[model samples]
Target: MRRTGPTTVTPVKDTGPPGRGLLYGLGRACARHPWRVIGVWLLVLLAAVAADRAWGGSYADDFDLSGTPSRTGSDLLNAHGAAGSRGVAAQIVVRSDAGPLSAHRDTLTAAGQRLTALPDVISVAAPLDTAGAVTDDGRTGYYTVRFRENPAQFEKSYVGRVDAAVRALRADDVTVEYGGPLGQLARPAAADRASEAIGIGTAVLVLLLGFGSVAAAGFPLLTAVIGLLAGLSVLGLLASRYAFAAASPTLATMMGLGVGLDYSLFLVTRHRKLLHSAEGPVEATARTVATSGRAVLVAALTVTAALAGLFASGVDFIGMLGVAAGTTVLVGALAALTLTPALLGLAGRRIDRWHVRTPVDEPDDSGDIWHRWAATVRRRPWTFLLLGLLGLGVLGAPAAALRLGHVDAGASPVSYTERRAYDLVADGFGPGADGPLTVVVTLDKDHRTTGAQRDALARALRDALTATPGVAAATPPKATEDGALLVSTVTPDTGPQARATTALVHRLEDDVLPGVLSEEGATGYLTGTTAAQQDFRDILADRLPVVVGVVVAAAFVLLLAVFRSPLVALKAAVLNLLSITASFGVVVAVFQWGWGSRLFGIDETVPVESYVPMMMFAIVFGLSMDYEIFLLSRVRETWLETRDNHRSVAVGLAGTARVITCAALIMTSVFLAFLLSTSVVIKMLALGLGVSVVLDATVVRLLLVPAAMYLLDEANWWIPRWLDRLLPRLDPEGSRGRAESTGAAVPAGRVTR
Candidate 1:
């Protein structure tokens, strides 16, 4: 590697604040032993990949709903041997063009037998034997197949066997489709290869334009790819140990790429600035790490902290998703701190060697467009602040009407087997049949009712359910072998995830079942896939407030400690909250109101996924803080020197605005690319996150922040002396340099004038 400038002979000491001290030491070590660090990272990557390939488990949708009625009912059913295991239940639909399916009884029987023989299949109930399996038309029919395990936990090869078994029934006049969990397995993989490609391509283009150097552009992308790979490998390993949602890795990838690229970009930008002063590569790298690297570290921790706060949601699966995403962020930060510096050392001056054109020097900010904009904002603070607030308020208005619920297979495209199966079942047996609610009755041990009396009571309960307002039908009760449990399947008139269905579930839990069963010395639990989903939604809604409180409080405290100014931290929290709400509003409008839904491939209005708001708040809040820190750090440095609030605000905004804008664009592009995802949840997340970044960067960071600081004047930096003394010094900008001294404050009034 070609050396950029003279090497520093003096040894660097760890005498700064703890964060900077740690980063400086790490930088020196990596710079001195670049080869060793690189080699070690390579080995780790390999080991992670190898281990994942050998032992890693695939993502699944299994959730631990312990203490919920669903769990109780599932356990009771399993113990009573009413169903196969507590595994997944699927549907195999067959439609014959020739005539009624009953005419092809022999073929249907053989198909059912073949399905039962498939790997992991616990049992298959033939349409010929099962009631409600065939439509009134008699041309369409379905068989219920039960698996020994969740289909998500089954090997990919098992899906092929299922397809083959179903295909065997596909005659020239017949069409077969798989539904339920099996259909979910057959659905196109949710991973968006195109989105990943487009995101990286866009990042490369943006980086090149910003840096004017191909090598500088490539470095961030390369580091992010490595970090993402490592993160996902670990995620795969984690999935083996614990059940993670199928979207976990995808979520991790999105977060990992955004943070990884942005972190490296910060460090690289600082390095370039130091290089202009003729600092040697090693010294410059150390200083960059000490300064921008510290900022990266704090920002990463803030994000991780916010994500970890999801644990407060009281849903293990949602919390695990947060953990999965946080794991990637942690890995990305580690890479930015260590792997990036090592690579910088290896590249030396060659970091810019691959430029398509001569790399432009970092520009002076005094007369820049951002500085002029800041000057404009300072001139009319109230006007800008009002405009910013109004825009955010309008955008966030729709959030007032936000409805949280799960999306059903009916929302998926008809091309998907699960969706087709769902449609067939709906068309034949009514939408309610797609998600029947099982009423599980467990009798009191001391009940005086004999088996015959219990039977009469079950029949009465069934009649009552059938007479219920929203119930379409109620099956005759079936007792467990031990006679301790009785289950009656109740089909609602509405589809699962429909508002009416949710209402019916609550009704059964609160009124109908209790009114009928309580007098009989028995308790009824409404449990099934649909009921469990409703319960999950309820849990998310109940816990969302706690999760938001924890995340916001944590962020506020961290910001307060860092800035030593309560006003600054409070302003940040409030602004971030505004941005998040605005983003939520957009999600509600587009997704729930069906406004421009087709632009993102959504065919119908759907309830916002219940967990989306909580997850988005944590993520967007942390990200909004990232830009806040970057902007305010510069502003604080300028304020300390000039003691002129307006000047400091202008200078700070001018200095960091360009980089922050570029970073936000990069992050937004990364998130928006996920719009192509097949999963509605992923699409919702992508749009919400992308919009939040744009609004935060342009509206909040640029307009609101500057205007607020200008209005607050000296108050922006005010902190009680006692509090200042008590708080640890957190210099986001390292101690290597100071802003040029301007004359001390004229009186505060005079300075403002």
Candidate 2:
């Protein structure tokens, strides 16, 4: 049934084709050997649980300055020990309602003594020592506590003690408000726990809502949990070999659950649609496996490939993230292709038992919103195009002023011990006390410096550091050569003072040391958290273009080959850019600008992580494209048969909307689950990504895409008639046994007859 102009439309009914025999066979296998799939996955889950329990938490000093330059930069001060000059620096601001210092003297002394005796306590200085501890107002007092162990090396066990102490102090009517890296890190560990719980719960709720059947809703979540367990087990093994950071589990959980559930959603949605149309459940399940399964494999490969590019970053953490995320996605894909279909077969008709009330005489190709959208886009392509461009430009505006810096982990959400401890450090000790800078001076191999030369070099290094505007002071350089090497320490101003100090460190390295080294034929490597950040930014800027190009190129080829429509493929690529830009804009606003500073409990002054952009690009590109493929695949199926661009877009959108919405919801929930992790970077990444995916599926994919396509009309399908002739046909519409579809209408008795 087809109509030319807009008119009252009758809902089209689908009558699935006879080619469902393959699907039936898959269902039969699952029905006959349900345990086959269950047994294997169960074993995997069990093993993962076992391994996680056996292994401990992860904490690796990938950014330590004494190591290779990758982590040994100024930006990675705390990683190397800057809080102790560069380790975990905590300043506790203890206030009393008992009048003044004289009235609460005993309580303050007792609290101070208790803190000073804590393990790994370097030194605790209180107001009793001098006026340094008392605020200018004289009502508030600060206690400075430096850790003997590098904050990077602070043990979880030690953090627990500090947390207990903070709690116990409340009994004394003393409010313990603290700030620092130690407290920050501790805070998120707890939030991470809570966030994980919320994420898992959200996933379950969404799955049930979308699937509308208890069994169906629970199936994907079950699969995801299994995948998470297995992925974490593998993560544990990796932890054994590398200095994997604590944030890895959060990342693993997110990628595993989000991708795992989304893949299952796609497969199950197709399977159910087929069954509802009279294809035997078995047959429908098989077809879904073959078609959607193929799509899943391709999608997984694309994600893995994008993640793999992180290896080129030459940064260990980024490299580890690439490997870990890639592994989890692969594992999740495997589970989808194998375990999911097997589960469907086992469940048989029960899979579609959760059906919503279907409207009678639903248009086989009539009045679908997607169709209207396509018609509109085809008619007025330029308006939609311009509008899309403008939106992207607006979102990308904030990215221009993004400033990278080391954010205290406690600033994330103050529910963890680390954050409490960190706050204490900041309140008492000082800011910029958590991360420090290292200056490495290496002499020319030809120069064997005598004693006088060593003294001169030390003196020159100290004087140069002192003269630098930002540096608080420069300690004498320790000579270590056959006199070929020397190391010096420079302390920056406290807190805000540290900003100028960090700048001064850079000035010494960039403006001062280069000239000195060049003249002496020696090389100076200024390694600190600040320096490392600069390097990371440089590396990311250089490689981002390559990463974006590779992803776009790969996606274009895949879409082009699949749809046989260059216009369609190009549209997908452009839309992806829009999705990413909007998402990145949101990330920059929340994480970089600290706009909601008090809400997340992070300092507005905290710098954005240097690698956030690169990581976000790889992740957002892959995840966003997943939605792209899911939506476009249906549209392609419709367009191939009818060759009516508007009709095809409508039919495709109608068929896919429910499934895409469900999948997006699940994926967003899983990503937001990272908010449970104890790392600021992890939370920020998760929050940014989660918000973006939701927007992409709903706003970009659903509304704008269809509206624009609707306006385009026949032009949407236009290819240079000449180029169309040269390109080999990719769609299989002409082949027998395949369903015949018009761009607007799929005939009765197709897959979902």
Candidate 3:
């Protein structure tokens, strides 16, 4: 079936050869005990589900600032009874259309009484009880219901009870809305079942088209889902030990599902090809595991290590997110390694029995379309390289203008109680009322400081804060019970999400507070939800580069070890960075610049969520390695046989491009399907991940990488001889099998695959 080409293409000589050891043994052993392996996997899935229901932790956006100034200040105040230790509060903005809020006093009181009696609520302060809680219009006001435990600490049904308790406040003439963390908890749960169905459906369609067999299509989906569900359960347990963000699980799901399927797909693709060789099912399964499974393992390890490197950033939340996502990927790989072989064993030679059509013919020889494309590139490396660079440059240009900040509730969907609360609060008070800064000033416990000096400093601080450039108002300083601390509320002229608001926080902390407090031996800290979020943004942005450096270095070392070529490792790192830049640019354009933001349910333009870029970098970098390793493994495998880089690149591109393209399509579909999530944050993650996979698979893998290697020629595989000895070799393609493959060039009955 081999076609004559512009040039001859060298085959792998030894590919998926049964002589490959270790992984082959694992696969054969599992295949021989198919029922036992299947049973064990089933038990694992069951245990994971049961464990989550019994002892799983809660999910919330609990960004704990352990050593940050705001956290330190807040902790001191809470310890000294300056900050309310009454626990978390649900802020309710109330509006009356018929008359002033006074007209609805009885209803408000009843609502408060019911809330106070509700489970976990520690106290309730109705607007009428708290002076200044009502606005000047007298028609709008707010109240607080303090709960003993944070909302996530409660069961899901608890939200229903709170909803019922506040029903009286939502009459024809009155309305109630939830704000702050409470608002986050109050938002309706997004059902991802639809998205999951769509992803599976798309995967099935793609599998059928490629494999042309119904039975062959289902195993990948089944194993992926099994691994994913179990992995998710594990993440829930991790949430108990670590405070991961609310979006953590969704992010994990997105990664787990994509990788889980792709890993399984590779194994099954190899197994099916082996089966067609008329080899016994057990032998074919073993060879498939030895060959394709080794690639999956290396790819998985590389990804896990890269994600773990996120810890280098020194941000626990970011690092934990990486851990969360990495866990799923690890588990997914485990499933593929053990479970896929068992499934293959169960199916035997009948994998094609439930046929939809003959499987698509994939040409692995040098004369196929991808081979010709690679040949064309090899002949004109500069043109292909420049074209790829042009495309990537155009896509990534928007990243230069990325703006990172908190996404306020004002950006939440209108259907969310949080958004309604944000709007009502802004209208009733000022735009900044929803995110007031709490200035906590603590004087040293000295007689002079506690006396006239303390009074003088507090006065000066109040004067300076109110006169500050962005300040709209500042409340008079109120002393705590010990009189050791003074707390004041500072409102900015702009909303909490505005750049001006962040500038104001920095201005006060750096200049205004220091100027007054230093004279009195006092320390002033900006301690409030708004200020804490600003701290989060600043910390993450500052550490972005550290994370990038860690991930890139980790990848370079990994590639260098696997391929034993410094240039190959460096090319992969650079190409991965290009993929990330393009993806980040797309996210910036859609979410920050609002260039069709509405398509993703964003109502208005907003700053890119502060942590999004860092998270994206770590994830995209790891994922890009999957394909990088896949292609490079084959190229290296071929090079070891012939020591010819040009023929190896061409043959590798022709051989793997079909599977990689199909795999990219499947992964992209999974990521894109998550766009159905109501959370704007999740949608942003979906688009970024999806776009990255597409661009990386096409522009980078199909164009830039091959072109670069073509131009580099034999230099691509040259490693400094001294360093080569120091580097450990991890041949993902089984070197032992190469001796067996030399006899036939390629296994009989193997087509373009």
Task: Please name the candidate that would achieve the greatest TM-score relative to the true structure.
Answer: 3
TM-score of each: 0.92, 0.76, 0.94
Residue 660 miss distance in model 2 (angstroms): 1.1
Off by over 4 Å in 2: 1-28, 55-193, 204-211, 352-365, 368-382, 409-432, 444-449, 494-502, 603-605, 676-678, 707-753
Q: 1-753 in candidate 1: lDDT tens per residue? A: 221222211222323222337777888788778999989889999999999999998887878888888888888788777754456788888888788888888778887888888877788988878887788888888888888787857776777887677665676467888888888788777767788898899998888887788868877888888888999999999988998988898899899999899888888877777775535788778877877787888899899999999999888898998999999999998988898888887878778888877675445656777778887898899999999999999999999999989898988887788899888888888999889999888877653347777878888898889988899999898877777878888999989978899899988899988898888889888888999998889999989989989999999888877766789999999999999999999999999999999999999889999889988998898888888887887676556555567877887787677678778899999999999888889999999999999999999988999999888876776666567657666667653233211222211111221
Error of 2 at 368 (Å): 5.0
Candidate 3 accuracy as lDDT: 0.83
RMSD of each: 6.2, 7.7, 4.9
What is candidate 3's TM-score against the reference?
0.94
Q: What is the C-alpha lDDT of each candidate?
A: 0.82, 0.63, 0.83
Instruction: Report the lDDT tens digits of candidate 3 across residue range 1-753.
Output: 342223233444444464657888999998999999989999988998899888888878776788888898788788888645457777878898778999888989998899889977787889988867888988888887778778755666777887788787886468888887778787777678887888888999998987787767788888899999999999988877878878888888888989999899888877877776736999888877887788999999988988898888787878888999998999999999999899989999888888889965446566668888988888888998899999989999999998888988998888888899999989888898888888988878882345676677778888999999999999988778787788898988889888788889999999999987887778888988888899999888888899899889988998888877788899999989988999999999998888988888887888888888888898899999999988888787777666567888987887678778878998999899998888878888899999999999999998899999988876786665567668775667674366445643321111221
Residue 345: error of model 3 in Å? 2.2
